[model samples]
Target chain A: MPDNLQQALGASTNEPTASSKSNLKKLPGDLAMWFFILAELTVFAIFFIGFAIAENLNLVMFAEGKAQLHKVAGLINTIALITSSYFVAISLHSMRVRNDRQAVFRLILALVFAAVYIVIKLWEYESLFEQGIDIETNTFFTLYFLITAFHFMHILLGMVILVYMAKNAYQGKYNDSSSESEFSGFESGACYWHMVDLLWIILFPLIYVI
Target chain B: MMKFWQRYALSWGWLIILTMASVAIGQYFQYATLNSVLFIAIVMLIIALKGQQIVDVFMELKHAPSLWRNIMLSYVIVVPLIITLIYI
Candidate 1:
């Protein structure tokens, strides 16, 4: 897609016109973001149902199992994700303001949050397992491990993208693009980061509250 | 009035408020079983709305070529329902 918004308002951003950037078409970044989201949601749905089913058989045990989780750790992860989402927004906003340098900086901030999220999640999981609550022991841990393990994977992927975008900016690939390429890359990054944030949104309550 | 609403009243503002409200209600109804379920549902709803808003506004899919925007939105909406129908 050409970056000329005056022209692109009537055009599709999916059709990258720059021959040099044709490989971008193959990635289909937006659709891929949502596709991964759908798949993750499907996995979470199974975990949720399994949890409820186990609850039906043994509500008290499930409740006891849930109470064992660390609320402080969960809240910390929630704050980290929420802050990363903010950084994602700031990065996108900086791009709109034509500040590529600032955009890269904000993405690094998001990466920091993703790293903190991973560290806290692993620490929490280790502590929980030490308490003798394995995923196979019951429904609570079953849902907990599946949801968090998948989210940990996403944090890893987002960190990779952040690093890639940072390197691309260093090389000036994203800086000189037509308005469309810049906007497209920035928006796609936000789309992916937001997907990460959205997963944690649902995961937080699943593991923490309900 | 509408422009003001669109700016200050961006959907996420309302969503954050709704999130806070849900948390408050969860605290008050601490032991209510169905409310716990509702709490999670509300959180999911906010996240869904936020995702759609990002795609629609920042991605500019809202004003994109109809074929792309419609189909994309359709998948976004349908995927969640299909997940629920098949699992939850």
Candidate 2:
């Protein structure tokens, strides 16, 4: 099998022979993480559909609203989130290879990149507020604030989870040899963080570009 | 023939390039042309692909069960396609 497929299979060659074989059918991360991911995605999908319909109703206003948005800031945030997601993935990969110290390091790196995203986002929001574009300004501004603010809350939550996971890793709570449930913190946190990134990928284009 | 970071780096590289491309296209349509279906269609395509990259690689859904993977893949493709058709 290809290397990425093998990694995606949650297989690291260093695992003991028994666990390596057994892990093949197991999904990465806690089962509860999948449930949360599904719920989060569903809510975002509804919001996205709602935005689409609203934009169709008021195309000119939506276009003008999008024009007021700082596309360069959105673009910068996109890169930051994407880079943070990359670090999060690598952090999880480090744990799977049983490098708990390295995992902690990578998780901190992820948090730093996520912080960059938050700073840029807040700057963008401040610019909008200075321009007198608040949530009650119009339908387009309303949806933009509602959706992006909701997504911003998720990013904050993900950061908290990452911090807790990093603490756990510091205490050596996770390793590839550990039981799946014991490793839930790392996987669950990483999954939620990625969901945030996933939502932003669509959100960026929908509100800022499209 | 590749290390793990190399594969991830490739994904990141693609993401950055596509992001810049989408922004440029967005600007072109905004300032130069109005009511262009092709521009909306192109932006929609980029959105779907970016969503796919996040689900498949960042989330590692590619190795997930077919049911899980297909569910996400459908969202990435269908949602933007619908919006594009309606708006464009």
Candidate 3:
């Protein structure tokens, strides 16, 4: 069999021999991390569906609420989060290559991008508050605040994870071995950060544009 | 073969282009007299594309185990479909 097919079959069977296991396509990060990601995505899916249902019921209110949002700020936040995800992905590549210094640098860059997201989000929230908008404003604003604030908290946690990964990379913790599992923790952290980015991509359109 | 980082950069470029396209589409729908259902469909389609890029390229799930990869990929599809259903 071709190498790619062989690897796929090995992975599917979940019974690769020791040698084949080395060549099988594997999920990045710990299995537990993937489960965690799935759980988080499920919760966000519920929130997204709820928002859509609410919008369906009150089209005028939802339209008005969306109009009040800062689309430019939403655009910038999307760019920041996507850029941060790219940096985190590159940092993982660096770690795999045992380039600890570059890994740490890229991770720090990712954190900087995330910080941009934080500042913009807080600014947007403050602007809304100044306009006398809050969760109790209406069903539209209620779901808006509930969903975005929940996501904002996730960004903060993702940043903390990035910082921890950066410190570990700088300390050469992930560069100690060629084993992929050695850096699974770093991969898990990167996955969480990307999950944050992924959620924002959908949220941007749902709340601000659509 | 493209270097991993180079591939990632290409994906990032495409993501930014898609983001710009979505914003333009959103702005156009705001003024155009087109069908709102069509607008929602286009926006959701763009969103699905963006989500897929993040899952496959940024998250490096393209070569992952089938079950996990399918689950994430399905999110990119299912959520948009649900939103489209609600909007339309």
Ranking by lDDT: 3, 2, 1
Worst 10-residue lDDT window for candidate 2 chain B reads B1-10
User: What's the number of clashes in each of the models?
Assistant: 3, 0, 0
Q: Write the per-residue lDDT of candidate 1 for residues B6-67, one digit (tens) a residue.
A: 43236445445544554555556566556444454554455456546545653445545566
Ranking by TM-score: 3, 2, 1
**Which portions of model 2 miss their true places by more than 4 Å?**
A1-10, A14-25, A176-179
When summed lDDT is taken over every stretch of 10 residues in candidate 1 chain A, the lowest stretch is: A20-29
Q: State the displacement of the C-alpha of residue B73, model 3, in Å, after optimal TM-score superposition.
A: 0.5
RMSD of each: 6.6, 4.0, 5.2
- Per-residue alpha-carbon lDDT of candidate 3 for residues A1-210, written as tens digits (9 for 90 to 100): 133223323433423466765466677777898899999999999999999998999989998999999999999999999999999998877775567898889988999989999999999999999999999999999899999999999999999888988888787766554533547788788889989999999999999887
RMSD of 1: 6.6
In model 3 chain B, the worst 10-residue window by lDDT is: B1-10
Taking the true A–B contacts (Cα pairs closer than 8 Å), what share appears in each candidate?
Answer: 0.11, 0.55, 0.79
lDDT of 3 at B36: 85
How far off is residue A12 in model 1, in Å?
18
Return the TM-score for each candidate structure. 0.70, 0.90, 0.91
Per-chain TM-score of candidate 3, chain B: 0.96
Q: Which pairs of residues have clashing backbones in candidate 2?
A: none
Identify the superior model by lDDT, candidate 1 or candidate 2.
Answer: 2
For TM-score, the strongest prediction is 3
